[model samples]
Target: MNLSWQTRAQSIAQMKAETFDILIIGGGITGAGLALDAAARGLKTALIEKRDFAAGTSSRSTKLIHGGLRYLEHYDFALVREGLRERTELLTLAPHLDDPLEFVIPIYADKRRNYDHPLLVRAGLFLYDLLAGKYNIGRHRRISQAEALQLAPQLDPRGLKGALVYYDGRTNDSRLVIEIIKTANERGAAIANYVRLVSFRKDVNGKVCGAQVTDELTRESFNVNARAVINATGVWMNEVRSLSADLSDDDKQLRPSKGIHLTVSAERLNVTTAWLIPAIGEKRFYFVVPWEGRVNIGTTDTDYHGDKDAPGAVQSEVTNILQAVNAYFPSAHLEPSDVISAWAGLRPLISSGNTKQATTAVSRKEEIFTDRDGLISLAGGKLTTYRLMAERGIDLAVEQLRDHFGVQAKPVSTKQIILSGGGIKRVDLEAHAHKIARAENVSIETARHLLHNYGTNAEHILALTHEDEALKQPLLADLPNIAAEVIYAVRAESALTIADVLTRRTRIAMLGAAMNCVEKVADLMARELGWSEEKKAQQIAAFRAEYEREYLIAR
Candidate 1:
């Protein structure tokens, strides 16, 4: 399972021979976590996805690894505790990818807000710190109105009572997903992206034994068998449910809600700390987070009524975000022109009671349903608690496999294992980064960027530089990433399209605010990878279209 995207060819070959012990669907955080869990438990496992890894809602999150402080308002102690515990684990396991971030929530007067907002927020942060225990980054503190203004100059000064400051983890959400997939591959989980689950194959006993899959890029079809199949598809769970004809409407367990985000330059929000604004009439709070030199200000939770694959961030929703942020940060009055980019994602929420009652009232916890037909589906978990979701999903699948195959499997051991580049133990990460740069004859800045992004695996790209010095040159003249990385993503990460490389593998298109630089990379990639002229044209067109879709504009 050397979980690199390249392993799909081998997994597809192996699937043609016989059935695996467990087959997991979805390739986002939960699905990736499940694959790693199952493989580590000594269960012969494989995972498949319909799109690139984290291409869905997983990549378009607020990118916070907090204990859900707002959940404390709703008294969801269990969910908060579990999330707190997972946050500690993720920080310890992937330090290079996850780091501590300070946040401020200002108390505004005349807003008809709670008088004890500071104390309430303090209590939540205290509990969050307590749960993190030895792994906690820092404790919560209170700042005077003047101090708050000094920290965030753009914040509205009028009627400012005080602020509650706390620390939480921030991460590159998509990179974390990719690392999990790589770790699962290291543990023997065969995972592939751009592979769609077409239908289910049942055995003589009417149990789901495998799935019929179609390669979205090549349009080729194949069959793979498994003792137990798990559908971890986020918003697309109903499609998998429909594949099994015997499953009825009752089998559909998802009610997806749309979460939209606006990407703006980090300069717009000059504040260094992430800010949380109390919602005027909603249970939710808006977050202004920093990521990759940009401010990922989002998001608005609302009931979705549209296609999950091509969901658009309507102008009305964009207006809501801008209005809310402007209400707090008067100096940084943002408009549509300030938007570098925007995106919408469908959270595959489990439909239990009235999902429309209150957007904040909906559960953020996951639900596991093992049907009588032996198809296991896990849905409705937050990005913070994906590992727990995976552990439960794999635990259930193992029970089904042991009973069916008459063989025992090993216990899960992912809790203590370091993944991919995280396996490298470095006392001085900065010094190590410089060493790699000197060895590769690349600049220290370039080396530091790579080492931070990929940890020890940065050496792989450097190795390519030694073979071809030209590969060391940057893809775009101004970008830090080089051609070696683009080639590595295509050849090693199993990226099938130019958008996959620009959007996920390198994140150039999103950061640069257009595909102008990325299109040039795509053309260079086309020549190096031996892509047909028509193929290159098609990729360029697709890249432009996706840019328009995410930015909410028509070309």
Candidate 2:
């Protein structure tokens, strides 16, 4: 069951022939998690995505698996506790993708803002550690201002009261989603990308029993019958929910806000640990996270009312983020030229009655609502708690299945079921990576990168290099990724388009070499997938246009 275009026809045929126990819509982290949980329970499950997996919000996250330390101020203890628990599970399940990282919250003597006080910040860290309990990666510690400056020399020293250090997890956001989808597929779930949900298919009694889906690539239409349907289309939840017969315009639930991040060279920021600094004037804080050998400074949250498909980061948003980072690290005067790339994603924040509240103040809790037609919709949850959210969604789905379809399924055991490439112990991962590095005749850094991203699956790509020595060549100079990854993506990872491989699968696009290597990568893909010259050119053009629109913000 390859996820690539090679098996698309077979996947569609199977979808039309079988009546799935559960049909999931949306291919983001939420939908991926739900599919994994539902399929793990021995239920006949199928998932359809209008775009490539994680093409939207899932791929454009801040790339942290944190427990939302800032939420402590709101007294949302339950949400924080749940997130910490999930963080622990993810670290164990996908050691290669997720790892523990240290974060430093620099305190300031800002008497005007009570929350910025050193004592209060220390108390918050204590509460954060307490919430993690046994799952705590590292206990929170307080350091003197001198010690803080030694850690982050670029930090603004004036009025710096002290700092608190804590531990959180970080991950490759897009890879995590892809692995989850792959795990679900491995468990007898029929999953297809570029298969858009055209409309909801209801039975004679006006009850939704399946979905009318269309293949976005081939433009072929088909019906997939199922016992229950789920609408997990994150920010576009209302659009999908309205497809149901009973849901109306008044049933709108999502209050999406745009969060944007900028990628800059790590040497420019000169910080090894993550920094949680207060965003200039906002009540919320912004992070200067270290990821993929770069400094990821971001996340400006503001109400967005624009195109949901491509939420481009405006110049103002970029400027605001730059200002926040500069405020913390005054020595690092990062201008627009320093920005390697920028990306924006919508947070499917659940709406509250008080419209005046800041987007940051909005709750990040998950809510599952089932309509009269048995269409289940989920919205407004952070990435860290996705598995828990899935368990809850599947529980509700199982209840509906028993009531309507008389199907009995086993309870979810996702916590115990390790994800793909998760069998190796964390302690042994380094030695295993070293062996692969020696066999592949590549640098230890390159081998470790592959191991970190693909875990045990990295050996498959290494084997391809042995079959063809050319596969060991890098896509571009100075990049560690080998050519075999591109081929592996098409043959095994369901990557159909140049954008899919560059942006999500391998992340060459976000690393500031997308335009430079698009033609070469497209040619490679064309050779493997048998794309015509015109189609190859079209794919390259499309990737270039998207990169310019999303990453190259006008100064």
Candidate 3:
């Protein structure tokens, strides 16, 4: 049942032999959520991803689970309201991955811009809290200029004014996607990564009945027959649609927005609470989030017309973020050299012909598009409301199934079902982690890291250390990550490539010394997966190339 390379052969064979009720394309959060919902409802489901799970926008997000407070400016109350509800659900369903964090919006007296006015900001927070209702993490409060400085010493005190403090949730974006996929697989849904949907199979009536899939790793082609096909690919929606049939100029959809973020050491900024700072002259505001012991500052939203697969962070984009961070925290004086890593993601916004509209003005509301060929594509939604998106997408899919195939399926109840590793209570997490630490004879930090990242599944990793003491050693002296994580990713998670282990599974590639540990981790993966020496070398080189391409900013 383990989702490893060893099981991929068997899984692909099964996929080709058996007919499924639903074939899900794209393994991001939207597709993962739908697969879990469908499988939980007792439908035969299968999911395929061309790259690693969450390899797209899902992994490169600002990493907040908050209702978009800025959406209030655009009067996007419904999107914000739905996002708030899903935020609360995720905190309860996956406490280990999502946690509450405090945010402050500093108001300046000298710069009384309409958006930065204290009264206006407070009013927005009021509506934000009202929408959250009982699900509100904490009530918003106002503080004096002095108190604001006390809370965030690094803040620029030149334009002294008060600030508003509110609460929201943050998460490890990639890890959340992986957990959803794993939960679906555990529930009997056949999920395969590195499997690309090459084309579609249609009947004489031109209805999509199945898909032609290819294993990217093995270069093997096969066909999977299904009663329904769901296209959940994010920015690549139009690209996948082309495989079914060409579209006219008017039919071309998706206004992809490029958003880039930079990661710096927490010590450089030294802010305990997250900050929402309005850009000097733009309607958009940049986020200064503290995550994983580092400061994550980001996200410039501009219309993108580049290759979807290679959304690299340009120097101009990085400079914009740096200027914003420096303006907010004058004392920090953060330069490009302070940046540890940088990433870019494309938001799949449903295009409105108004090319004059700013990217920020685009609505994040999701839409389900069904063509005459029965190809259902879900596009243009934020990560916060993925569950609701899935529910709506599946409702349409089920309706199609009943109408076209004459099949009956149960209703979805994914809200009641906790995702994998969600059963552990927050109060008992420390004690449980302590017990595991003692049992495994590893450091407390290491145990807590495992518990937080893998949740209740930490025990499975602890077992690896028991089998081989070498697995308990740290991958890097400064990092808490152990060698066992690399092995567990291969044996338990479907990590086919070194990039899968380093970038998505463990996040070692984003941290410092990523290149230094690549060969070592590759060696462990080779030992477990039986990679030849040449393959191991290839993995190391490929991982380094990806890190330099996607993460490294030119010095």
Candidate 2 positional error at 119, Å: 0.9
Q: Estimate each model's TM-score.
A: 0.94, 0.97, 0.97
The best-first sequence of candidates by TM-score reads 3, 2, 1
lDDT tens per residue, model 2, 1-555 = 346676666778899999999999999999999999999999999999999999989999998898888888889999999999999999999989998998988877765322366777888889999999999999999889998898888998988877889999999999999999889988988899999999998889888999899999889899999999988899999888877753444545478899888888887888889988776555677788888887887787888889899888778888888888888788999898898898889999877546788888888888898887889989898888889999999999999899877999986689987887777777887998789888779888789888888888888888888899998888877678888899989987899999899999988878787877788789889999999999998898888888887667744
lDDT of model 2, residue 455: 88
The lDDT ranking, best first, is 3, 2, 1
RMSD of each candidate? Answer: 2.4, 1.7, 1.5
Mind sharing the TM-score for model 2?
0.97
**Model 1, total clashes:** 1
- TM-score, candidate number 1: 0.94
Error of 1 at 427 (Å): 6.9
lDDT of 3 by residue, 104-192 (tens): 88888666322566777888999999999989999999889899898788888887678889999999888899888888888889889
Supply every candidate's count of residue pairs whose N, Cα or C atoms clash at under 3 angstroms.
1, 0, 0
